[model samples]
Target chain A: MTQETITTDVVIIGAGPVGLFAVFELGLLDLKCHLVDILDKPGGQCAELYPEKPIYDIPGLPVVSGQELTERLMEQAAPFNPEYHYNEMVEELRKNEDGSFHLKTDGGLTFHAKAVVIAAGGGSFQPKKPPIPGIEAYEGKSVFYSVKRMEDFRGKNILISGGGDSALDWTINLEPIANSMQLIHRRDGFRAAPDSVNKMHALVEEQKMKFHLGQITELHGDNGQLTGVSVKGNDGEIFQVECDTLLPFFGLTMKLGPIANWGINLNENLIPVDTEKFVTDAEGIYAIGDINTYPGKLKLILSGFHEAALMAQAAKRYIDPEAKVTFQYTTSSTSLQKKLGVA
Target chain B: MHIVLVDGHGAEHKLEALEGWRVMEIIRDHGYPIVAECGGACACGTCQVEVDPNWAAKLHEPREDELDMLDENYGGEWSRLSCQILMSEELDGLRVRLAPISVKEAA
Candidate 1:
């Protein structure tokens, strides 16, 4: 299958608050932006980690939930018509000989852009791997963090772990197809939706599946194939549950995944950028938000907004050296106001 | 006062504690490996700690939000989000072992 390469003026690597605001800043300068994020939707950490948690530090808004802040930012950037590519992580970044940047995502989407913005806050939100010894050996084979296709597990003995919605939902969805299904959690109580929990319990009552209260301690298998798992029950009893597949949903955590291999200078996992332009050593490439570091840098949403504004000016100059960039206020500049759709 | 922190490797360090500061702050300030990713918001369970059973009852009960976050992190009975525990005069020398999940692996 042939994939078309998208060409744009600017490509923002993250769709978090900083990246969203970058769209507005670049938009004011008449620069079109295409944002790529690893999440299925926008609002990186805010939407993923703590959507309901209140953030008082955002300027002007004394109190706003994470999800609300993300929505407002998205709305503010809507006038720019910023295209967002979600659920795709940019795995490769290369500087083209022609001075433009070439980028490719894990999902096979490619882009050529005049400027690149790295606003990934704490890197990509990846599935948190449980601290199970020797579990890495069976990662892609018998042990899986996410189920891409439910049909693959059909007729296989499956053991699902975790008490969250993923665990309970998958336990119900896959029970009908699996040869045997067992749900193991650290506790009897679940954090999943009430209806999902009820459905899971009903399946258990009907003997459609088994529910074990314990944590997986060992994976018993070889050559990346699993035959069973040893569980340490809450009552201190150790038992083995025979299974051909293991799915663990332990929630998500931020990791500086592919970014570390992008050949940029990193200071303890954070990109170091100039305070003025928020630009890394790489020409036409910028890093902002919590993923960047500079003298007196504060990892706050407000600070990232300031970075995005300055970065846009630098990016505009880089994209077109002869273009004159005049500083103007949104409240007074009609051109800026027109770009914001309020003129 | 001081709080004792047991690292993942079983090494212990006694660190100074200040009033009104979360236990996560104390551990992080002392240069331990705790991530405390959300900056003491009690949202990310990366600052989890296994409180010594003897002193677990002395700390204030885990609130609903804290418990919910812990549940996502596979927390147990003695497990608590260090960000939720505030340093207090009543609990002078609290002891908490850093949960394995909370340790920031060397990058």
Candidate 2:
């Protein structure tokens, strides 16, 4: 309990590229930000979804890797000198009588800011877990939902579950290092990219590992030691496999935490927001990025950037309802002057 | 509900949480005197908690964030977040501990 209260002009919740861009946008508007995130670094889902995957349509670059794009956003946001609070989820958001906001975190820390931006990409940013019974009991024990490092799995028995590109990619990745591997999926079908699947198939042909097409029915272990798993295929075939660790790649995800109950009208899971107005059902709160839903808007990283920019302008208007839109340039003038070298 | 940390790394602190809640939720509900910042998103290392090492194999993959955080952490093998842990019948006598203090940096 340190009595020191940290304060900022705005708070950006997620650290994804769009969220990072929000921090940058707030800074461009001459506002300081406390860019809080759960990752030790920025770059939200991109870090997990596609670190090396190429991304087009990011404006400026013809092609960029996800990790590179995240780095760029972090650099752009660096100018604002935003304070960082990594490894903490915003436990609660409370507004004071005077209109200022109070921020609390899961880590027992409190922060104060003028405005809040819920930039969490695609709901809450945690890996989806397997539905097998007793799985939760061994989260920190032997079962895992993610692949942290390759070395950690060396000489260890590992089982990966998922039908998506992430699972396939991880399977191809850990093949060389892990002591033994089992790639399991509930459905006989796979959602992975053709190339990745092909590669995994090639690796499987090499007789280096194994693959099981079925959903995990149970994880059997004792005293925290995972011994094996039960897989029930669509054809009523039950197979039991032995393993020291289980990594289910079945992509389960969440969105909007407690804010979902704030009475905001969400189209599906995201809050439907007007691209131009950036208004949500809630009067004071505005949404941007993957959390925002609007007609004809395809959910993508590029779309999120657009949402973030529009929402920043709209939020400024909301905060100062009496102000009129001006066509004049605000802070870019200095940058332009610098570009022209006409000091 | 109580989060029993058997690892005994940090000052043993127990929290009163709702039953049927995720282990991370209880720790988080009690102000995360233990760290679960990602909300058990398995994305960061700050929530790292060592389970009763005897039962460590039951834990699953560290996920992207958990793995990333583990790579950047002090002790890799035993570090994990309580949020990723669920409290249920199987985990009745589960023992875990708050990760070391240094890992909380930027967590």
Candidate 3:
């Protein structure tokens, strides 16, 4: 396959609020940007983890949910028409000899950019696996952590373990297609929304599927394929739940991922960035948002916004070494207003 | 001052802390495994930690906002948002365990 290469002025690694804001800031300076995210959509952790959760500290918007904040940020950057490549992660980053950066993602897409921005909020969101004995053997086979494709388990015996929204939502989504479905959890208490809980209960009452109060103790299968699982019930009884496919929604955990392999300096698992321009140890590369750390750094969206503004300035200078750059406000600068389509 | 942070794997790490710095900053600066999703704004409770019972008395009471956020996190008696706890000379040698993160899985 001929790998497609996209050449751009700025390459942002995350599509979260800060990354989106970076596009606007860079866009105002007439710089083009292409964003890549591991997630299937923008908003990073905000959209993936807690879309409905309200965030009370986004400065101007006294109260905004994570999803709303993401939408508004996208709208704010729409005039720039930043290119986004979702459902992919940047696996490798190398600096070209000519001072440009080369990046490749897990999906085989490559980008060459004059400047690179790391706005990854809390790194990559990885699925938390259930701490079951010998469970690792079944991973990627019968035991799956996430439902990337709904049709993978079609007509298979599916067992979902968790009392959270993912478990309940998948139970509802996969019940009809699954040959036999069993929803298992430690107890009747659920952390999912009330409506989902109600729907799950209604399905259970109708005998469309079964619900068990237990925890997975062991996986029963051969060579990565599962035939059943040993479940320890709340009443201290161990029983076998037969299923060919197991989906455990243990929630998500943040991993620094491939960025850790990059040669940039790291403080803890975060990138150490200079506060002046939010630039990392590497030239023409900047780290912002929760992924970057500095003295007295606050991992707030507003702080990332401030960092994006400064980062754009530094990036502009790096992209055009001999050009004179001036600071201007959108409210008064006709040129800035023209870029935003407001003049 | 220095403090000890216990990660999910039961490993202990000693880290430097500055006076007036939020506990979240110290742990985060060192790349320990606590997620302060809202930074230090006291909005998100992703930075919850269990203070050592012995040192719990030395900590200040959680404000109403912090308490409310903790309630949202289903906090217990020992639960406190690391963002709300400021480091001071008095807080030296503090040992804290990360609160197990329990997030509702979204579809």
Candidate 4:
């Protein structure tokens, strides 16, 4: 890994709606931002968990889908040209004597920033692994938690587990190119969209692929080159499913992950911050969104948006101590509009 | 300002508090045993507290979301999510008792 270091005015963690809004807020002040997220995309929970779920609490907008909200936020922050490093988890965060933060990601990327914003909503979303012995050995080779590329599964016998959108979506996506495709779950019920599930059933009826009602029991592979898998049916029959690739989507769980080790004070796994600037006990580090706790803090996207506004103001002062601070609204500030490319 | 917090064990402790901070923040900041699993989102009722009967009438009415959470997870008199209660000068003498289901009990 190269030891080169990248510098930015501010480094915002998590690319959720709040983090995306932080880009806009900080960008308006002429401070560049870089956002890091564990997921491959920008929207955190909203995009991963419930992209199509309708959200009614966002102010002004009477109704909006989770995916739409993420899209709009990304659009609003587009002019800022915020750097997004997706599919990477921040592994280390340390304070330098110079009062700036030195950060490192699991993907071997590094950054130095004058200010840091923790916009991670309820921490990082970790994939739930199935209960199979020695499954770790096959991970990253034949077994995968998420599909990053469709071409990787091309011409391979792929067996996908789980009944969620990820499983069904991948099943539909990889069907055309795979040598053979099979889907397995505990039962016939699926938590995925009905339309997708229907399409999967239609495909199965046409003999394009196979669907099995069973749970993964064992792996039939050596040295990570999966040859096949053992499946135990609900009716107590054990059978082998031939496949070289496995994709399991058991859903996701939230964990504070490495953020708990950053020397920041955590109250029951949530960061504590002051209401004024939403800054944590650690100087130069600000916590916004669901990851932060304060008196009367509302863990809503709208509340995070408000916190991002104040956080940008405080972050500006921290980055430029001698600079004059002026409050300007997007509706009235010509400079802000120009930065947004709308003036 | 100072506010009184009655722990789950019925021990009362007074702590310094800020005027604009949330009651949940004050409790958590002092290392009080409360679990805000969802932070202040009002989605998880882990931070539930029973406002002192007398003070309940003095505080603002719970919001619609707050009410939905209370109705869904907790149904007790004066039960409120401390995160939803903002501290103010009028709330200086606020007295809140920890509900039966705190982070400790839930965990």
lDDT of 4 by residue, A1-343 (tens): 6978989999999999999999999999999999999988988878875576678899999989889999999999999999999988999999999899999999999999999999989788777666678889999999999877888888999999877678889999999999999998765666678899999999999999999987788998999989999988878889999999998876665678999889999886789999888999988999999999998877799999999999999999988999998988899989888999999
Whose lDDT is greatest here? Answer: 1
Write model 3 residue lDDT over B6-53, tens digit each, in one string: 877788889989999998889887866566765666755778888889
Candidate that scores best on TM-score: 1
What is the per-residue lDDT of model 1 for residues A45-78, given as tens digits with 9 covering 90 to 100? 8898878889999878999998999999999999
Model 2: per-residue Cα lDDT at residue A21: 84
Candidate achieving the largest DockQ: 1
True lDDT of residue A194, candidate 1 = 88
Local distance difference test values of all predictions, in order: 0.91, 0.68, 0.85, 0.86
Better of 1 and 4 by DockQ: 1
Candidate 3 wrong stretches, greater than 4 Å: A1-3, A191-195, B1-107
Sorted by lDDT (best first), the order is 1, 4, 3, 2
What does candidate 2 score on TM? 0.54
Q: TM-score of the candidate numbered 3? A: 0.79
Better of 1 and 2 by TM-score: 1
RMSD of 2: 16.5
For candidate 3, lDDT tens digit of each residue in A1-343? 6587999999999999999999999999899999999888999878876687789888878899989999999999999989999989999999999999999999899999999999998788777666677988888888898888999989999999877778889999999999999998765667678899999999999999999976778889999999998888767789999999999886665678899888998877789888998899998999998889999987788999999999999999999989889889899999999999999
Model 4 segments more than 4 A misplaced: A1-4, A133-142, A147-158, A172-181, A189-209, A217-232, A235-245, B1-107
Where is model 3 chain A poorest over a 10-residue stretch in terms of lDDT? Answer: A185-194
Docking class of 1: medium
